[model samples]
Target: MFEGHGVNRSAAERRAASLTTRRSVKKAHQAAWLVNAIRCIDLTTLSGDDTEGRVRRLCAKARQPLAQHIVEALGLGVVTVGAVCVYPTMVPHAARALRGTGIPVASVATGFPAGLMPLHLRLEEIRWAVDQGADEIDIVITREHVMTQNWSALYDEVAAMREACGPAHLKAILATGDLSTLRNVHAASVVAMQAGADFIKTSTGKEGVNATLPVSLVMIRALRDYGEATGHRVGFKPAGGMKSAKEAIAWQILMKEELGRDWLEPDLFRFGASSMLGDIERQLEHHITGRYAASHRHSPA
Candidate 1:
């Protein structure tokens, strides 16, 4: 059954609150987890001022997220981010910069952040991004569909967008903050996955309320249930407002608890962030030297 399951808001709230209160990895273990978090970051740049040069620099950073010295001190080799995300117009720039690096280039399409454009135009944007050598496409679902309880319409739209992605992976951004209720968020997650979303993402980063623990609990449970029912695993991405190393650890703990360690990989979980990498790097430096570096020392660009 593809119907959405009901969510208990109070219980979900309790669980979310507990997630923050629970102490997580620390010292060396925390550093190691931060390294893993770095590997799972979709280092993103989605500003209106984005340019080809900016996208290229973002790709370069993705290739070597940590300084060579830091990587060597950690006893690691060439630790790169999961992917470099950019706008459709900069896909070619990112592709050119990341070629032969194994790291994929992800482009946000389907009128991202708003997704209020016409369906045909949105699908066309996906095709264009893929054609421009985007290995993954982050698409925003039409919030109006979910708001109006138009599940079938939402399914059809996401299915078409997935098809438009062709060989490239499709990540459906639910814009959960705009979905009104936890039940609506659950329903949208189910509909997107049923229609063929490779991953169900939380926010567009433009939302006023983005990527909260309570909302994450709702969506991840949906992922767990979908996996149990269909035996098909889908990925989860929590974007926006996830800035600190502590926030990253909280999300990692959520995945570990709900879906086990198998969901911890870059393929199954990703942090849609741009500033997050800098903080993780800073914390890793502190782990090594007991002193945090200046923010500019770990700039994303």
Candidate 2:
């Protein structure tokens, strides 16, 4: 799945030891191998295809309808809805619709992407989304504060979002694109988990650079190590830029190779992507049709 592993255990180990200790390495590798994904896409699916002309409209007219279509298309199946990543305002909409299917509706909150808003507003966003029926909240740690090395405010914000979540699952988006290195990403993952994140995600899916095996590997490694230190098993969601089924499988391959086989399910792995559905569809077609054909949306039978 992962094309092939270039995992230098020695290199990975050296990095992992910096965050906590060598103990975290085992499971971290497992997570990296398994939960190869938390499949997701944003509100753009409400309407429009991927074209420059629709760029404005793609962001527009998109709301609950788009999410519902994806839900219906997913139907009840083995492939899974992963988690529906929507704006805080749409969480309730997704929850009401996807309820009983066991598909968690994840709302991106706490002033997603930019992290420019006040903590109270962000907390309110998370609280409101939970009120709307979100089973999980994908939150952004304060990137501005993190950039400033203002650990106080950043940790406070993460803790605040943590408290606001109150039993709802939390996936902390460190927005790693802003962070400078794999070391920084590893460190962020550890801090986020220590501050109470149930999962450490790589991006907001808004940035130019999104999830990659290298970045994901670092975060997963961090979580694994953190788990050993504290006895908590964190999850991973590598959002944005996951473009194909091959890539999705590569994540699985990475997990299987780097960590092991334990972290391969929806509980541990998630692929955050809007484009993945088509890729999955195409692959599914190759299975059913005997040849690879173009893919498109079909009503859920």
Candidate 3:
């Protein structure tokens, strides 16, 4: 259905740039926005050195992303991240850690960062993660399919992965940085949603470039159009290289502007960032006290 679709990079860039300059939220409103961003964050850790210890720690942080002081000072209650994301093997640890907390454990499957593996193996990985208690699966798409304009192949692959996920929500990561064009990014977003992706993500946080606003604009527009055409609402996630409260607020503003406040919720939008929580906490702390504290006071995520 996305054949011959085109995107204007210059127009997307201009619009993305305007999101930062055109809107401003301060004091209580900014603090509320930051807290909402926390609710929609996929607090992630996907390194070669990832261990159960580290995963447990990350899950602990996800359970209580902000300090008690911050939560109390802000007059908020029961704050937690949307989910804790980790490798397939770490799913069990994350699940065990977050059990009964109502926080889903998300795993990256289908050969994340690069989906160059055999299709069956990739599908199997999804089932394995689900069996290990991953409530959500983030699967990477084969950039080759998009680059070669093989929309059918991409659709079939994602559909198979969706089935393999069983009951887990499927998040298709387009990794737009590798797609080479906004047009490709738009097409991939539509195909992934057509293939039953519950959410369409921008990156795996391991690309040469990840989650730029311009690329994200293209994907968001594609999903918006798909929703209009099919009556299905898909979620959006922009992962990687976003590490500031300003960025957290900017992306939320983009979603709110483009798709309204419905997209601002955790169910419809998320930031696939690991280190972003620290900066958000810092900003909220400053809002509470009218001064910034040392960064180390906020624990790493």
Most TM-score-accurate candidate: 3
TM-score computed on alpha carbons, candidate 1: 0.97
Q: Write the per-residue lDDT of candidate 1 for residues 246-274, one digit (tens) a residue.
A: 88899999999889998899999999997
Better of 1 and 2 by TM-score: 1
TM-score of each: 0.97, 0.74, 0.99
Off by over 4 Å in 1: 2-4
**What does the lDDT come to for candidate 1?**
0.91
Query: Per-residue lDDT of 103-199 in model 2, one digit per residue for the tens?
Result: 6777778877777787789899999989888888888887766656666666777888899999799989888888876656766676777778887
The lowest-lDDT stretch of 10 consecutive residues in candidate 1 is: 1-10
Q: Runs in model 2 with CA error above 4 Å?
A: 1-79, 297-301
Model 3 residue 16 distance off true place after TM-score fit, in angstroms:
0.7
Best by the lDDT measure: 3
Between candidates 1 and 2, which one is better according to lDDT?
A: 1
Q: Each candidate's lDDT (Cα)? A: 0.91, 0.63, 0.93
Error of 3 at 256 (Å): 0.3
- Order of models, best TM-score first: 3, 1, 2
Q: Candidate 2 vs candidate 3: which has greater lDDT?
A: 3
